[model samples]
Target: MDMFRRTFAEVNLDHVAHNFEVLKAAFPNTSFLCPMVKANAYGHGDVAIALCLQQAGARHLGVCLIEEALLLRRGGVTANILVFRGFDREGAEQLLANNLTPVVSTWDQLEALEEMAKTPVKIHLKFNTGMNRLGFSIEEAEKLFDKCWRHPKIQVEGVLTHLFNGEDADELDGDSADQLGKLLRILLVFKPLNPLNHSLNSAGILNALIVREQKNPQHILNQVQWGLRPGLMVYGFNPLKRQDILPLKPVMTLKSVASTYRMLKVGEVVSYGGTWKAKRDSVVAIVPIGYADGYHRILSNKAEVLFNGYKVPVVGTICMDFLMVDVTDAIHGCDLNDLRDKEIILFGKSDQGQFISAEELAHRAQTITWEILTSVGERVPRVYVGDWAKRLGVAN
Candidate 1:
């Protein structure tokens, strides 16, 4: 056990189930609940998280790349997997053969996909609704829809668009409204072309209240035919800033253990930069996790980890395989007992009942909740626990 490094992340599947239930309750009318599981299911391990989500009644799974879809197919995930990012000609056949849906963003991709062996492939045409990242323009989208509608080998399952300013709570503007309006206009141009028309993400749905109260409601949400595509909310992170108003829970809790402990004199510095100096005879604990392990280097001396039920301040520069925490106050009595190999709560919770929320960690890191979840390194072992875990055949 010592050879394996006492540190590993424990993922709570119960929280994941809770998060799924919350999303289900919020959007009871959703036709397809596609939870994004790309980037190793946001570092929770793709197979494990996808299995857990599938058990929790997730009908569809979303991944960023074709390889991710292939990985899931190989892992026995039979659910309808949608490749959010459309692929090129090289990967289109594999996408079709594996029964994976690609969100076609351009006419060239659609043309490439058309040349594949004549198997009716389900595809979602991504409309460039303000994000300007992917998807087709109004004219291009119309032409592609017409072409695919006429083609015998292609089955257009959905027409989707992403919101650009969904996260912003302030300015209740109509940019999103206009984008949705444009999508509808494109849909109408290609008359009788109705394939699961959807245009909202977690932020879009969460921010629907704003759209309802704004100048135009019909233009933004009323056009959605299929339902919503919620990624973050399904994983238990609130997409809107007004999360206090709506009940949402975080699904993943990243937990690791403390591997070693030491005592440092008053003037001694810690780690690579020697930036952190001990103010007093402090007890320092080293966690076998660092930047190389996905713990951001920005959190060097600014972060805190829960140890022995207490929040201990992290000291010194974060190295590749370890980080130091000032534990003088934490070493008094009960907190100090069995200090060596004691579990360290990195970004989740402690055994003694202390917890660090992902939102808090994201704030400290000056990034988004998505980044925090996706940044979790591969080395950390994921242990799924709860009803969903049991249903997925993962041990507690």
Candidate 2:
């Protein structure tokens, strides 16, 4: 870790706690939260984030694959883990061994598990309400219910579906609502089992996690279970791309130090491809971070870094290990003397009042905040902050 130099990701776990509270507070107490910790908690480090969220009252955690679940279990996470990507036979056996829930999305998956099981296993049934990405068709769920109605080793404990377009639609108008309707019908069929149900993702939670089912008002299944599984929102991002009413705190701040400075004359180019030419004499700072570190090449000359509370624009094509930022205007009094090792804020708050959020970097990279966060590479060692760091014996 000592060889890491100054470039690394600084994670503020307090923000995660704050974001969790904000998301959970939005819904009723009857609701449950399983903040998605897949993709390394969207690149914020899954094990750490998962543990913090669990401590904050998350009953279960959602991951996309079996490896992710295994990683969590290995990390000593004892809470219920839900694997969204329904597994194959081998994967199902492993999931069962780990006590993780595999969402049965396909009928083949159901039959395979039923055939392979030696003993009973709890499962969550997933229906392809509309996403069509995964899950069983409603007909499949109904038929499966009949088959599993009394089958051993295949207890359907929960029902779930994904909302493909939760961001654009309101409560009762769009595809999300329709998907909810489809899921509701299937749930009604499974009402006798009284399985826990879920359908909301981050966007759905923001707009509508719990909506009253208009028809069949008397049935218990008429209500949508607030099993809102928020992913990006837990990391303080508004997936809808509007004003973040939740105002979630950004948990990770990508940063590095200015290792060296460059003096370029007028008309001189910088970095590879000679993409940026100096209009006048310019001073540049070479930061030890680049596309290889998850700072996309698309940010070549468009990205900005914070220098002592000022914005320094990046110059030329970003290399595998480094990128140069024009510090000409920023190289006032003190920095002119020596630019070596001066703190450069890539995207996050600095001790000197300079601040940049993931949203800014995502914009320049022409990607979403989720990608910006999750794409941070492995080499950039993460420095844990907030109370989590203290409890984990890692805070600096």
Candidate 3:
């Protein structure tokens, strides 16, 4: 069905490909680039993005659950999907049936694999260096090798870990470095098993590049083939904000049009709590999107959006299905009819050359870019665009 509302998100598949190319070029030593598509590809629509990346030559993809992996398999994605969340017996069976790989983090997960495997199954072993969230701790290395790695049904295809602070790779004694040191030590124990080694996410990938450029043969990171699982960077937001390293074009642009306008007199308040009272005559554009649509309520009267090539302040409490923008200056010379066809950009570049990034919105909301991107509401239709979209017959 076509979009029923003027509000939607435009996803550029070309930008996705460009970002992939940039990442590949930045990390030439990377054996594979596993694009994380969890949380609906951070709300950009997973199936479409996965298909785009697969067409772009991605051999591997990452998702948080077997259900997500199954979604991709059903969507015609043929890449090697690594399910981050460990599975139960039924999930393990499904993984085998779909040719999906599972990351074994806990012993119970290993037991599930052992219980479900009738044939040899490839798996990535997750070791906890410092994150303390998931994975087998480093102290459990010898026990894992002895108990699971040698299990006949379980084939150790890769060894992996999460770097708690990849942004600190510059400091030799920093948390990231210390974590890498531990990972490399684990690699030493698993080297004979011949598993792919990976620990870096987007920030870690950039750090890997930094360490690579140094060309120090003695660096702890040079121990094995580096497989990177880049999450945010692939979708075009930099974790460390280092665009100079690899310039990334944002894939998703959230946009909407003013549904109608309201003229407010001085001292007249707006929205749920009368939080924003106009100090003078104001022209407010009522946008057809709100907190329910993934626009955060904290952004009420705190964020700005691009309207008619100008920055307009968001006014009043953001409602469940609407938001109000003060566009007095933006509509100075244009008739209301003139803006009927214009778009108001919540984030990403506007055709008129003005831009508002997700990072900017995240700052306004006192959150991170990841939360901002993933929080985009499921109800907001994702309008796919660009070369891949055209080829895939999903272009808008």
Best by lDDT: 3
Off by over 4 Å in 3: 148-150, 214-219, 222-225
Please give the range of 10 consecutive residues that has the lowest summed lDDT in model 1: 217-226
Q: What TM-score does each of the candidates earn?
A: 0.92, 0.93, 0.96
* Full ranking by TM-score: 3, 2, 1
Q: After superposition, how far is residue 292 of candidate 2 from its true place, in Å?
A: 0.3
Candidate 1 residue runs with Cα over 4 Å from true position: 1-3, 169-172, 209-219, 222-226, 334-337
Task: Kindly list the per-residue Cα lDDT of model 2 for residues 6-92, writing each as its tens digit.
Answer: 888888888988999877777655455678999999998888888888888788899999999999999878899999987888887
**How much is 148 displaced in model 2, in angstroms?**
2.1
Q: Candidate 3, 320: how far from true, in Å? A: 0.6
Per-residue lDDT value at 186 in model 3: 91
Question: Please, what are the lDDT tens digits per residue for candidate 3 over residues 84-173?
Answer: 988777887898889999999988888888887789888899999999898999988888888755688988888999888888765657
Poorest lDDT segment (10 consecutive residues) of candidate 2: 212-221
Question: Which whole-number lDDT from 0 to 100 does residue 382 have in model 1?
Answer: 73
- Screening candidate 3 with a backbone cut-off below 3 angstroms (N, C-alpha, C), the clashing residue pairs are none
Instruction: Score candidate 2 by TM-score against the native.
Output: 0.93
